[model samples]
Target: MELSVTAVILTLTAILCLYYWNNRGRRSRLPPGPPALPLIGNSLHIDKRAPDRSLIQLGRKYGPVFTIWLGPRPAVVLCGYKAVKEALVDQADDFGARGTIPSISKVTNGYGIASSNGPRSRQLRSFAITALGHRGNGTSTLEGFVQQEAETLVEAFTKTQELPFDPTFRLTCATANIMCAVVFGCRFDHTDPKLLALLHMMDENMKVISSPWGQLYDLLPNLLDCLPGPHNRLFENANKIKSFLREMIQLHKDTHREGTPRDFIESFLAKMDEEKGNPRSEFNDENLLLSTFNIFLAGTDTTGSTMRWGLLIFLKYPEVQEKIQSEIDREIGMDRTPCMGDREKMPYTNAAIHEIQRYANIIPLNLPHTVTRDTEFRGFLIPKGMLVIPLLSSVLYDPSCWETPKSFNINHFLDERGQLKHKDAFLPFSIGNRMCIGEKVAEMQLFIFLTTLLQKFTFRSPVEPSAIDISPLSSGFSTLHHPYQLYCIPRRPARRPASE
Candidate 1:
């Protein structure tokens, strides 16, 4: 009995020593951070509800660049404008690779750009950017489609008659319809049941994926795989979106002719046929489904969420909205639809939109980046395959970068002459080669959609402007604005005054 007890004690001591040395070696190789426990690592330390905020706070204590263990995985987080710019901008090639989030990877099966790495990602992303840039022979320009959707949105808002209504559905359909036209060569009616359900799934999936549950699934995927929770719903939603896209693909397969590609999907299908005999060809049905999924999901949610946040900000600061409206009316006139050309001329409206994006800080914790090689950055060496997070919230809200980092001030993007001032840190689409590919497209949609809305309606908050809570419900991978209703009073070209 005495010998057995001594052996057990010796074994425990050995295990502890091994764990200590292992962690010590890791810390020596990575940037220093808060002490993390074995297995769970820093999970307990992070505010699950707002991991990005927690990471930002740690950035305060640990300097601009620091390391944290997510489960057993160590991630190097680049905070503020300088650190993020250094790694993602100065050392772009080193930090350009995409990192795996288990939650997203499982759904994507490591297939698309969102989760793909190396050659596959390069091939797919190149095709995607080119495809997005192309115009279908018989279709209207993307701008024309957006303008038409803006008119449809106008019709939808006018139906509310200055009463309280949630803009989520209409905004979603409008923004998503652009991508729908690009990918599927068609648009869904505002009342389409399938579109509505797909949007509902996407919205919830984003919520759950940004939630603590989603973080855990990313951190400890294998352990959580057998467990039951809302995190599992993401996979279910993925499958549903898969079925939806698969059906769309099948329809395209039947209708799409060889050589002459009509839509994004057909373009991809054409590529797939070209690469049929090549063993390394990444063009296949799986890639097609996932690439489309990534395009559609991303194309829909980020812009949709940004627009919602934009409207929410408008409700909070009526002056900002009025000023933008005044600028729109002055530049574009209440008669003509707002155009991209008008953007260069409308300084205040341009500043307001830029400020809105900065204030909104969508994708606060940018999709994680990876170092494919051992990289030395800012006096610290990041190991190859280590996950890196370019904390965009830090950059957008960095005091050193923005004059009024904490406030929703248009002056952040404005000069004394009231001209739009471009800040190097205004990167809601993030920076580097891996940045959001839809930047220009999103910019046009935002300018047209917003200017069109303000041209037609003066939006009013349901609550007192003082009571309007523009703070997001949760902040992580995405900042989800709290659901709120607002009233829309028509302007000149839309309709006569409600009272008149």
Candidate 2:
């Protein structure tokens, strides 16, 4: 019995020594990072509760590119424009794949473009771009869609009798309609239960994904899945969205055509049929369903949040708002509704819109991309499957890139002659091949809705400047603040016809 006990103790001692030796020297090879504790690593130092600020603090100490331990996983953070550009742009395809967090995998199921890599990712991305007609210079296909949605939005808002109103629910509805129009080839009224559930799911999923608890759950999903938490709630929400997408797919499948496609749903369904027999086809019902729902979540919130931010800024900076209003009046005139084409004529207004995107910086750290192959960036070794985050907020707010990154300066986008100048650093939509797929659609909506709203209503603060706290609260992966309401007061044009 003593012999057996001695053997067991020896084996335990040997295993512990091996584990210690394994982790001891591994830290030096990786990039500079914070001190870590046992089992948790640097997670103890990190405010996993507020990863963004925690990361920003770490970036200051460790330079732009640094490593942090997400439990046992090694996560490399790319901060500032230089580091982000190096990894995402200079070494584009090297970091084409997305790193799948345990929580994200549980939520997304490794199905959508946000989670996958390789040929499947490429195929889905290529197909989405083609289907949306987001190609080349001056594409009219997406512009037309934006214009239609803006008109419908105006009609809906007009129903409210020029009274003091909160634009949140309506604005979300209008923005969501455009998303729906793109994905399912339709729009939903704000009161629709199914649509409400989808939006809530999108919001909740984002919240859970960015939380500390969420991070822990992601790191240990196998064990966590058996227990109950916010992650589980997010998963349930994701499933509901999937179910909604399935219903929409069935509807599209029931009524689809070959050459004459009705909308995105019809077009995608047609593709599935055409590629049905192919062994390598990725156009199955499941992919189509997930991709469609992905659009609904991605397209709607980003644009809607942006518009909400734009109005808040307008209320804060009335002079700038007035300048935009004046430009809109001169370019599009008081009688007619503003369209996508009007964007060029109204240069100042366009610049202001662009500035709003830069100032808001909704996506502080963009969707994480995985290093697909071994690559070197700025003399640092980036191994395959490493999570590379491109901090877009760094680019938008880069001191070298912008003259005044902090100030809400429209002039940054305006040249000496006050015409719109597209700055290379102004990449709210992000850069390279794996950029936001619905970028064109988002731009179109921004131009149309921003211009249209300025023409119709002047956003004003309900109380004094001191009463307003413009600081943002955490929304999700995105940097949206508290739910502040705005008053949309109708503006009477300089020239009203006798009919009015």
Instruction: Tell me the tens digit of each residue's lDDT in model 2 across 1-500.
Output: 99999998899778757876886554445677876554466777666545666787788899888887766567788877777776777878787677776766765677766665777788888888887764212354445656666777777677766555667667777788888877776677767898787777776777777665677786677777888777788778877888878888888777775686656778777888888899988877767777777777888888988998888788778898889888887788767867666777888988988999998888777777788876676667766777776777778878888998878898999999999998888888888778888887788788888888888877767666457655557623677655665666678867557894
Cα-based lDDT at residue 280, candidate 1: 90
Q: Could you say which candidate leads in lDDT?
A: 1
- lDDT of candidate 2 vs native? 0.75
Tens-place lDDT per residue, model 1, 98-134, is 9888888888888976788888989998988777766
Model 1: per-residue Cα lDDT at residue 46 = 88
Give the CA lDDT, 0 to 100, for residue 54 in model 2.
Answer: 73
Q: What's each prediction's TM-score?
A: 0.93, 0.90
